[model samples]
Target: MIRTFFTAVLCGLLFVSCNQQQNTTSEQSATQATEANVYGASFDAENVISVTQLQDAVAATDSVSATVTAEIVESCQSKGCWMDVRLADNSTMKVTFRDYGFFLPVEDLKGKTVVFTGTAKREVISVDDQRHYAEDAGKSAEEIAAITEPREELRFVADGVKLQ
Candidate 1:
């Protein structure tokens, strides 16, 4: 009888502990969501690009310049560092600052118009890292791996980006 009682107590304790853990996780997620929403505000990227193109013409007259204006389709939430922008041509391009010099909040800028100057290159977003990114974005494990679509091109890095 004592052994059965002890086993039951242990099971009860484990259940309570698990419940507490789950509650803590839920609370933390809620807090994070609130914080993210508070910091997210709409900003147009296209207007930023128009200003950047004019500045680039004067600053980089001798250098190779590619100025693009596009709408940010997606971005990393952890750091507003990089984003995927959809061009008018219906193609997406990853834009990141040169040498990781600059960053902007993704939530505030996503779906906004942005103009940037940089060199672009076709590259592959690795499957492993892509899965990791999806996980970080709070996607389920199955959802992470299910994203197998290849991103066509990435702007290697940009020297200047104007966000409107």
Candidate 2:
């Protein structure tokens, strides 16, 4: 009788343990889903082109809409309103959110690879705008003050962005 009782208890414990593990797995799945999607718009990685391709397209014309994949060189430290991504030729392109629709997390984005769908344009950013961006990035006063010339750069306005 004792042996039967012990076996029943062991089976019961195993069942309970298995049930708990299933719950934990479901919870983890939910958490992963939450983390994977950001800024509402879905990120499609299938059509993403390298920064080099984007640069070539932009150079061929003034602007083009494209899906691009690149490494985040830096992001707006204050609000994540903008980001800079590295290009294949060791250059960087500035990326902005589309229509002020969404923002990225302002922390821990540097050096991360991300895919973005957006329009890329070649723009001349004025010195005042450069200074403003520097301030937003929390640059030192001297760094902010060092801005003197306008920057001719490739700028992207992204409708959607996803960290990879």
Q: Which ten residues in a row have the lowest lDDT in candidate 1?
A: 38-47
- For model 2, give the 10-residue run with minimal summed lDDT: 35-44
Clashing pairs in 2: none
TM-score of each: 0.52, 0.77
lDDT of 1 at 150: 60
For residues 95-130, could you state the per-residue lDDT of candidate 1 as single tens digits? 666677766664646677766666655467777766
Query: In order, what lDDT does every prediction score?
Result: 0.61, 0.87
lDDT of 2 by residue, 80-134 (tens): 8999899888788889898778888879688898989989999999999999988
Q: Which residue runs does candidate 2 get wrong by more than 4 Å?
A: 1-35
